[model samples]
Target chain A: MKSKKWLFFVILIITTPLLATTIEVCSDCQIKTIKAALSVAKPNDIIKVKKGVYKETNLIIDKSLTIIGENQPTIDGQLKGDIFKIKSDKVVIKGFNIINVGKDFANSNTAIRVQKSNNFEISYNRFENILFAVYIEKSSYGKIINNKIFGNAKTEINSGNGIHLWDSKHILITNNYIEKMRDGIYLEFASNCEVVNNFSTKNVRYGLHFMFSNDNSYLKNKFLSNGAGVAVMFSKRIKMMNNQFLKNWGTASYGLLLKEINDAEIKHNIFEENTIAINVEGSNRIDYENNNFTRNGWALKVRGACYNNVFKKNNFLYNSFDVSWNSKMNDNLFEHNYWSEYSGYDLDKNGVGDVPYRPVKLFSYIVNKTPETIILLRSLFINLVDFSEKVTPVFTPDFLIDNQPQMKPIL
Target chain B: MFKILKYSFYDLIRSRWSFIYLMFYFLLGVVLLFLNNNLSNAIVTLLNVVTVLVPLIGTIFGVMYYYDSKEFTELLLAQPIKRSNIFLGQYFGVAISLSISLIVGLGLPFIYYGLFISDKIFEFLTLIIVGTFLTFIFTAISFFIAISFENKIKGFGIAILVWLLLAVIYDGIFLISLIYFEQYPLDVFSLGAVMLNPIDLARTLMLLKLDISALLGYTGAVFKKFFGTNFGVILSYLILIFWTIIPILGIVWKSNKKDF
Candidate 1:
């Protein structure tokens, strides 16, 4: 009797794939709309929509279904309301051009919204003129890939994010091109998420931002020319690697910002032509290694309350100021870094310089005290003052030295 | 004006000081380029040298040239030539010669390093333009100072003082004032102050192109609107030209009224 029950269970598991059915939706078909198709879709069914324009809004998917487009169908929301409110597990949405989602601030007005679901996939879709592209809330184990999201974002308060995650975990977001949104990707209380190889640019606010999120990692991403670059704030134990932050040049812009972050590792990243490459405030125990800081205004600006951060094997190339600190106290370690402004000789013929290199200049310290002193940059008096300060350290912390300055840049 | 301009210009072209000035820039360009072997990097270092050294050299050379040429001037005053023609011609002579040295000196190393194929040619051009403008403006001011005073010591002293004020002390005062009034909005005031001084205006022009304006914060925003766009840049160039013209006009006015 037990063997017969086991055989019957195996048979049922094998036959579940055969039980799934396909429903076609076309302009001339009996089921003309996605709403009509979804009304009859049971669990484990496919809704294949043919090539045409379907003016739909506020459609809900409540059952496990695969919705595929035959030739990239267009679903125009017509500035009405939310497009697809997905609330089912194991759902798949693919190959659709979604446009004209409503611009409603109170409702957050998303093109595709997923809530309280898992094992979902949203891929190969295009969204334009949306308030929010994809809003994932209370979701887990989902993949959002290869979606091009472009919004008409002009102001911070009037726009929404491209891919937003709230209270989600173990999600993978990859290969998405996001532009002109409030933020390209925003995570709030979202953890264990992997964001990889995405190009986010020209957002009204930050390209990528995280608030109160922990254990998240982003790798191989390119963020360019946004209002500000990636800001990881109030997060812990994050990993950032192989990312390119370029041309985020503005008055108050930084390539990366860390506030109250702990135990994070930033490696193999390139920060080029930003106003401030990395701005750190109240961040502790972070390891910065193998990064390139190129032609920025201030390569690193330590605001306050930062400690135990180690900078090693990085390249600082042709920045106006390599580092700027507001205080005379430092608990950070800068070692074995290649500074293009380093003029010390190595008499021992080793790779390390015999003399220590001080990265902070007296002018930068004065600029912090009097922001107007920035206008005096590259002036004769400032250079003279900085040279005297370098000879005898007084204003800057005496102990803040890179004793093992590399003779050549680390490749 | 053309005859006197030609005589003084040819005389300056044959002088040793002009050769030294040209050689100074040539050596600087060569050393900077060969040391770094990077075009953009050399341009950055050259920015500092150009902004500071250009004005200093122009001012000192102008004053010294004026005093050394005093006998020549008195002899010419006894001739049939107009006073303004003689002074303005000398002014242009000094300015044009210095500009030639700066351009030919810095430009050779850049062009040899394939600046045409490289993308930093615009920045290189901006640097040369700013350098030339600084030369003309400073030379004109120095000539006016020389003409106003008969005492050689006082003339040289005031000329040095004026250059020091414009090149160094003015920035010091501007920075202090901005810090003193930090509670108020300063973008307009700062921009106005920068526009009034030829040195500050030239520096701002170069700094804006170098992406250092981003450090100015909100003030940088206002400056970006005023100095970042094509209209603003062209307007700045017009202001720089005005800077050159006003001092030259002052030289003419003072020369016409002088008893010497």
Candidate 2:
């Protein structure tokens, strides 16, 4: 009996080393394809792809494998098909330059398609000229981090998105640079996703386009120079904080477009040089706090049908139009917001102004009526018109007034 | 024509794949809505769901409905009816059934929320109707595609690709043009550019109705100036209606000209 127990212990120790395998894949090696390497790899195995342009087609992995490319290996789709198709849990595809995915106008064909996978880490890959760089569908608990996706999309008729996620949950897309696609990061029916610290610029459409996605948090991202800055629609309980929306300048361009969003907390963000800082509609129970709006065309353009929104402790500086509302009055509360245009004195030396500052400009009212009057912006007549309207508010909504504008810039 | 409509409805309802798809989508929408809790969030969620699911289902179902019913279509053609009637009936029936399923899956939640919880009931209802109509538009396009292609795989593939373009790719193209002409007066360009996309039109219309067109800045101002009033709103609706009707009419014209 003592000999049998000793034998069992010896067998257990011998088999542990065989479980974790490390395979190397080179361009001219016996196993040339990533799929071939993944086929034979065991769980927890590391398949290292060597540096070279691999003109491979679709690669599917069904095991818990770690595919790491060394020296920034290139996986060229050759305009044929998807590069990596992951169907396993705990899979990592990293450090590869994926390019030239086939453009299929009928379906969302992506470079990296993750399906029914969990605990994935897609990091440090460079994607160029692809329909969709990274696509996650029906996947859960994935992290798409530190990837660069750029496309030269000329027309909306054939171009694809950058990072397209559908029916995915618990996703973390962080610290990536995405440009020149339809959307930098698109979330459709995705939930509990966290998009952080990414730079999305020069996209054909929205930097971030999310719909029907809920309980998401987008923090510390920079959205710049897109057609529209970002659109958060049909979502609830979203938290957007500490982001920079800059230079999203266009006729219809905006820093952030919030539609049908509820119970959101937008705080500590910066909106600079956009056409409109925040275009809000049909949203409710939102708290806008500690934001800096500088040099935007309109700092906050509040449409009608919004209710129970609170704007507090935000700094509005040098905006053309501080606020423009369509209706006479709204239930949305604007208090403690620092308006640089505030003329009321603070004799008591408190930070708060003595009198309430009305943020809605009279020129904005004129522009609302005759949009052609916008050509006269920055003119003395417009300034005079604005001044007279401030002294005696007319055409502009009567009750749409900012009650406690700050005496000094909130900085 | 009536027989075609009846059969199309019967086929869609009878198919196990459609049932499963509807069940999955309904479950997804309901679960997401319940989780969102807030009306704005729910609306965003609903929009996202509709954007992805509507196009996907429309393309796939439309393609498959035509392909799978080929034998039935031939059998019907052997009878004494006009090809246009058969095609129109099938098209309308497919559109109606899919729209009903979509309404039940996504629309019902918004209605439930609007009636029980919020005041923007009419606005939400309008959005749902627009979404449903958009799906019908896509379905009509899919029918044209199905008739155009000889191979089922090719037709399905083309339909999916078109869906991707409309749902995701078109926005990318708009961004590129905006960037390329960054030095020019972009507001006028944007107004004209956005009109090229029906989805963008729907989105703009919804925003206008919500009185948030000003948020679009110069572009929004221009849009409001042109369409902010009741007349403007009516014009926007007319554009949407034109988008829907023109494509279907084109398909009808093409179907009549071609020997299917």
Candidate 3:
């Protein structure tokens, strides 16, 4: 009988590391705090938090675990510091209401921060009044999905981004609704990220901004009424498709501002009613295809040094200036685009216009040189002057013409 | 003065000219709303028409009414009515009739198209208000010109010239000068130039509401400060009111001194 009891004890000890036991945490339980529960948890343990308000701050997770909250338990940080700083791989945090993260200039007080972690899933969470929501630094293979972040960002001086990814790769950010942040989603030096189906609106700066981020593709994200709109700068091989940029109207605002970007593919996008849609500067070898630019101030403003860009099958409708160029130099190719202001006739019954359409208006050139001249837009004299300039190509770049202008808008 | 105003108002209303004007606006509103099918964009197109066409109609109608009623005006002058009342009453008559034609003409089609329920109702109201202001302003200028000149052809010619200058040529010159003086700061100067002309003031007011995004795109701090707030609207109203009053005062002065 003594030998048999020893054999059972040895088997029980050997199987303890593979089991994932659930620890219940509530106000009335023995382990009341998530911090206390996490301290006693194993690598694959599951912590279930009950429905209650827990005033906690700086909860660090250094081991792989699953933290699930029942009925959206509110974790009020009380404006102290970062909450739920994950430092280990394979951590999952779900169904928590986080609020009141502190604002510090040096170290951002993030709601859910993952540092040097991999395979983390922060989903089904709500954040409000946060300095930085979901701050991922040096994290890879993380999915920040289905999270709603609302920030009280009144000014750009002290505001932080909603989902700030720094040096993170292979991250998936999808189905997030972020509002009133400094920037909705900011990525710096991050690569191979896929951001899809996010609604970012009313931010103080760009809705989705990228700096030196490469091999990223953002699809079907809607950026509306942001202060400066979206900017993809200093990036290479970025693919943006099927996005809607609407009503981001202000002084010096645009739907998208691409600067020094190379080999980017922008297709199937809608730019509507923005001040300036798609302001390109120094971007090379970009293909802008099948996008709709409607009712903007300037549909496309090539500021300077944009070369080898191909604009094909895009529709420019009712914009004040279809294409405005600053310098007279032209190396871009515009083909098969349908301009609403194209008055040319296709007498041969072909889909293309008989004459090539010149889009760079002399008045827009003048307005670019002396921006105050924009006040004379749509005036009779300005129209006459533009007409004369159109009749005789002078001041504007003569080589900037759509050789095959579509008679009908590409659906 | 009220009697003369009523008489002139009825006289213009009963004429086929007012009917044509009313029908023109009705057709314009109907075609714009139905064809465009978007309330905001239709209002923009209507604003373009209102800024240009309203002044042309107002100037020509004012000058034509004055010359057509010349002998009747001389008869009224022989009566106990004051000269300022005589000229001012005729001016108000033309202005009010034209404004009513504009309102009733444009209002019917818009109200039919569910403008009151739409969010663009305020923009439509601004367009109407600016249209009325333009009507009053240009009519006063034309009346002053008609009262100052005795020769019928000369008055008509000068009236047309003044309209052309304010509507088209002035803007031409303003654009040229702004481009020529591009090296200097031109915010205050451009605003002053816009305020000096009633047509330009009305257009600026309309642009403040319609094309605010593009207008604010200019990098001038003064321009941004002015257009970004309600200050530009208030100043436009003040300057537009000043424009209306100046011409009426000119009519009063010119009529009081002239031999007609």
Candidate 4:
């Protein structure tokens, strides 16, 4: 009798199919609502929402299901509350247009909020005019991909983020467009994430703002016309590659601001038309290679407390300032970078210049001492001051010179 | 007081699931440190992990500790013991257990460094203290939340929300202010904000201890000018103490007045 019961249980377990049922939701049908369909959704089910405006707020997804919208179905918050609140594992939300997330002074409200969940896929969505377009918190192993997020954030007090992830791990954010938000992409306490192929423009603040995150990779992203390009703070083991930072022109802005970032590999990037290409402070053990800086105000600005950084095989083209250092302590190395301003000749027909290149400008020292004198940038007096300083090596570190400068541009 | 402490500690110890969770965190830290080559890199990564995970663990554990022991707390309340002592004992017990797990998980790596590698004993010690202080601050906040809310889920939710506000949203707001007032000197404003945020204060203190305050540029210089010296460090410590103590005191007051 026991053997027969066990056999029956085994057959029941084996014969049960693990298939997900598909449900369709529309704006005008008898069911007529995404929430109604979700209410009846079982675990591992799929809800397909048709293209129409569904005004809803605080929609919760607790089951391991897939919510896919057709032709970018619009989920308007109606300035009420959060659009979708997800708290389930193995969920996928894709192909939706979300907008008008309510602004709350006390809460970091978002169009889509994923909380304490795992293995989510948020892709191919359009988010606009929201406080925060999509927010992932205490979630892991998620993908935020191919989304268009835009917001008219006039002030930081009233505005939130475009795509914000907090305390989440193993996230992949790729191929997205973000514009005119407080931050295009913001991560805090989020680790082991990969950000790639995103274009962020016209943001009020940073294109990317991440703090206390580790083991992250950013590749092939374009950050343009933002207040600041990117601020990577208190992070380690970051890999940045082949990105373009352009037109992030502001008095206090840069192509990148790295604070307390360590063991980063920054390679094959381009910085064009920014006020400053890279403003590095408190960063260490970074490898910078094969980058191009064109028509920037400052190519590299190294503040104090930076240590053991290496610059190699980079091209600096027509920048007002190549390098600006706040301190004389020279722990970093600059070698084999192509400088368009390099006046040294190669006597032995070698590609390397015979004389070392001094990247630190005399004008930068003068401007640091006298901030009002920055207006004299590109003036003949500044050029003469720079030439005299180069001849006499005053106000700049004597040993802080880039040896092995390339005779010609690398590319 | 003794009974509360004994029961709290015993409860934490008896929970094999929590013990496993702590071990998982420890193993994760160990794996990350092992994979990274640079000591500074490892320290940074470890600090980040601790900052994220410790607060969460502290909040959840604290909330659960209070809610689960409601019956025991009521039983103790029926006795002749003072509520403050009971609260203190429970608080101390919870803080002690979490600190032990954190020290074992995170502090052991630094101990290994001190034993075999460079003599960065002072730095390691400072790091551990900062980590502990951060955990304590969150624990105090969690205590307030646990005492205030009748529903455990709501209390946990509020704690998480507060953590997000303190850890992430504050910085976002500061950045926005800086952008809005780009022409003005934002040093004073930023300094004020930093003073208000205990998390920022702890981070600043840790970075200062690491002697990397200069890399913070104008912000670091402002902090140094205001709080980098011995007196400044003391003031910072006082501020952090106030942040931790005031909330716990508030919880005590609220708990004493409650009709539980």
Candidate 5:
């Protein structure tokens, strides 16, 4: 019995080191480079890289392993191709500062490219001066957290996005600081992504852009001073909550641009000092509730073909124009919102106004036709024209009215 | 001249219309602050009022004060005062008194609401300075009109007409011209047009300070370049001083050659 137990112990001791191994890569170690370490690593192995600059490019990781940087080791791609091409499943990359990936129009150069991978994590890294920070393609069940991406992009045609995802599913992009990129966080043909607690500012294009993506939700993210705030185009069932779209001021800038989007829920967002708070085009069944539009040029500029949308419990405060519709046909419902310009009294002591509020003004329509007419925005002549239009349905839409306008702001 | 200015300033302050005007602005400030409870909103609302109503009141009150005090002016002319002194004194008197009413009336509510400690202090200061400039410009222009036409009806008619032209009709023509020439760049034209009208100039200054000049399109950019920076502010102040000076010079020139 003692001899049999000793044999079992000897067998277990023999097989234990083969299951997993920790390979350390430093200047003095036997595994002198990460490439050499990764070459010998098997599944579930950890390759620890010590603090140094690695001048390598197009480094492909095909084995299921963990790569960790001690003291934030630098990965200088030397303006070559992608730094890390991740193709294996269950790979983890952490604490690497990546810089100077190659710029190629046809290749879509990125600091880290994860393709056809699952259960991957790219976290606690800094990406700078790269074309695309993190490109995730056809990947699922990944988490991108606490990454800072800074790009010095000037225009849309030449610049790339901070975080670009295509055909990815079930990804969480959280707590990333992205600045001066083209589009801060871009998703195309991607779905089921949760973007939370990110700060995207001063981008050349939209801060958070969605094209043909669905079931995506963003919460508590700040889009500040981007070219235009957030653009959700050609998508459905998207939810945006508690985000701040602030100070996107220009002739063509807006807090949120919705084009051909449907069944979206936008709640508790704050739009402040944008040229237009929400520019809606051909969207349907969207619900905008509890959002505050403050000091914008136009609180809501709705174009035609937008139907079944409801704006409720929102505070439109001191915007130059509350709602400007391009067409006279009205199908959207504006209810229970408090407008600072509503001049009606609630005689019945109910919280609603006795007279319905018509938010579109004649000047807004005229400005839509002739953009230069905005120079006459607060002129007395425009006020006379607006007052006349309010008294009689002339140029503005006749049926667009908020019948239950609140006397005070709906908190 | 000093005595004349003092008496006229004191007299205008004691008048019933001055009290009413003061009361009007006081009430507006109180309602905008205490009722709305939003300092920025109140400032916006006050912006509209200051741009439109201040010019109107300046013109009406200047014409009325000139016509109502014709006898007093004639009496001062018969005394030892020079013609330029009498007219300049009265113009300064009306402009200074009206400005005081505006500042004090609006300042009370804003100070009460803690504007001193707020970030909007610069915006409020801009508002005050713009209001004072409007008062001075319109008052000087009205005095020029009054002294230019000896007939009371013509003076009053032409004063209101001048205000209407600057406040409403000039913008109408400006908008029409911009639309008619939409194919061409209107940046220089719009900038020149704004400089020509004191009201538009004031509005542009305030809008730039409020940081919404980006909404003004091409002209907004130009105005921002000419009015958004420190050089712009100094140049605007110089131009505004020029606007005030030109009208006052007209008053001095016209009043000097006239016989009462």
Candidate 6:
């Protein structure tokens, strides 16, 4: 009797695929619309949409269904409202070109809004001119991959983010290309997420922004020419690695802006040609290693009260100002870094300078005090003053020196 | 005018002070580049030296050349040349010689340092051009001062005073006013003030090249729009040319009306 029951369970497991039906929706099909098909489909069914333009809005999917598109079928929202609203678990959406989601200032009208859903997958979709593309709120264990999001956003107020997460956990966002949105990706109160292998460029605001997000790691991303750059604020234990921050040029802009962050690890990143490479304020216990800061106006501008940060094995090449601090006291450590302007000799030739390298210049301090004195930059008077100040420390932080500056670049 | 220019240029180039000036620049360039091994820092140092020293040297050379050439001027006045042609030719001769010394002296070391192949070539070019402009402008102003005054000592003293005023005191007054009127919007005022002074204008141009305009965070938008764009660069060049012309016109006017 037990052997017969085991055989019956095996038969049920094998025949489940045959029990689930695949419904096709196209222009000439009997189930002509996605809404009609969704109304009739049961749990664990697949809704395959063929190549046609589907004008729809406020699509509510509340079942465990797979909605797949053939030959890139387009869903046009006609500027009405959100296109897909998923409130169920184990839902998969793929291979659709969604366009023209509405912009409502009072509420976030998104292209795809996932709420309280777990184990969902949103991949291989294209979004054009969307307000908020693939916004996940209070969702967990979801994967957003290989999506192309583009918007013609001009201002921060009227547009929304490309990929926005709020209170979402354990999310994986990878291989996405996003541009010209307010922010390429934004996370607020999200934790334990991984963002990898994405390209973000030319946004009106930050390329990637995190606020109060913890234990998140982003790797191998490219952020280029945004209004600002990437910003990490009020976050803890985040890891950022192998990212390229390029050409973020503005008066107040930086390649990475860290404020109130704690215990973060930033390694193997490239910050090139930014106005300011790294702008830190009130951040503590951060480890910055093996990063390259090249051709920036100011490589590092540290504000007051930032402590216990360790900067090691970084290359600072050809920047106008290698390091600028606004305060007279420093609790941070700079060691084993390669500064292109290091002038001390190493007689033993062990690839490290014999003397300490003071990165701060008195001219930077004067510029901070009287910004108008910047007109005197490159002036002989300023150089003379700087030389005198270097010989005898008067204004700049005397303790802010790299004790072991490398003789060569930290390749 | 061309013949007079050729003769005076040859005369000045072969003189001792010109060689000393040339050697001075060459030594400064080599020391800055070799000691610092930094192209950007060298440019900054070159900028400061060029701005302050170029005007002073130009003024001193102009006054000395005028006084030393008085006998030659009297001899040339007896010739068939027009008075304006002689004075303008001599002015161009002194200006061109000083500019060549400045350029060739600075250029050799920089080119040796691979500045032409570097991205800093534009900034270096701007520095050279501005230095040349300052030499010409200050030389012409000194010529005007020398021609206006019969007494050589008075002309020399006043020319040096003019350099001191424009190069240092004018900035002091400009800063005082900027601080005094910090409540008001000073973009237009500062822009106009910078345009009025050649040294300040040259400094502004260099700042635009070095990308330090971004450090001027509050009023940077105006400067960026003005100096970051192609049209603004052209406007600045036009203004610089206008500055060059006014002093030349003053020289011609003063030279023609003088009772030589």
Candidate achieving the largest TM-score: 3
lDDT of 5 by residue, B1-260 (tens): 78779989999999888888888888999999998788887887898899999999999999989999998888888987788999988999999999999998899989999998999999999999999999999999999998888899999999999999988898878887877988776677777787888898888778767766666653456644664457666766778889989999999899888877
Candidate 1 local lDDT, B1-260, one digit each (tens) = 88888888899989999999999999999999999888888988888888788888888888888889889989999999888899988888888999999999998888888999998888899999999999998988888888888898999899999988987788778877877988776777877888888888787788767767677653446655764466556777899999999989999899999886
Candidate 2: C-alpha RMSD after superposition? 27.4
Q: What is the iRMSD in Å for candidate 1?
A: 2.3
Give a tens-digit lDDT track for model 1, residues A355-390.
999998888888777675676678766777789989
Q: Tens-digit lDDT track for model 6 on A378-404?
A: 544456667788778887888999999
Give the Cα error of residue B203 in candidate 3, in Å. Answer: 1.0
Candidate 6 C-alpha lDDT tens digits along B1-260: 99999999999999999999999999999999998798987897787888899999999999999999999999998899888899999999999999999999999999999997889999999999999999999999999999888899999999999998888778767765765776676666777888898887887777777766675543456765775577566777889899999999998887778887
Q: Who wins the DockQ comparison?
A: 3
Residue runs of model 6 more than 4 Å from their true location after superposition = A1-13, A16-20, B6-70, B97-128, B142-193, B217-235, B257-260
Which pairs clash in the backbone of model 6? none
lDDT of 2 at A209: 90
Q: Local error of candidate 5 at A379, Å? A: 1.2
**Docking model 2 quality class:** incorrect
For model 5 chain B, the run of ten residues with the poorest summed lDDT: B218-227
RMSD in order of candidates: 3.8, 27.4, 3.1, 30.4, 3.3, 4.5
* Overall lDDT per candidate, in order of appearance: 0.90, 0.80, 0.91, 0.80, 0.89, 0.89
Write down the lDDT that model 3 would get: 0.91
lDDT of 5 by residue, A166-208 (tens): 9999999999999999999999999999999999999999999
Ranking of candidates on DockQ, top first: 3, 5, 1, 6, 2, 4
What's the CA RMSD of model 5 in angstroms?
3.3
Docking class of 5: medium
DockQ for all models, in order?
Answer: 0.48, 0.04, 0.54, 0.01, 0.50, 0.29
Candidate 3 has a TM-score of: 0.96
Question: What share of the reference contacts survives in each candidate?
Answer: 0.55, 0.10, 0.53, 0.00, 0.51, 0.27
Error of 5 at B249 (Å): 2.0
Which docking band does candidate 1 fall into? acceptable
DockQ result, candidate 2 = 0.04
The order by descending TM-score is: 3, 1, 5, 6, 2, 4
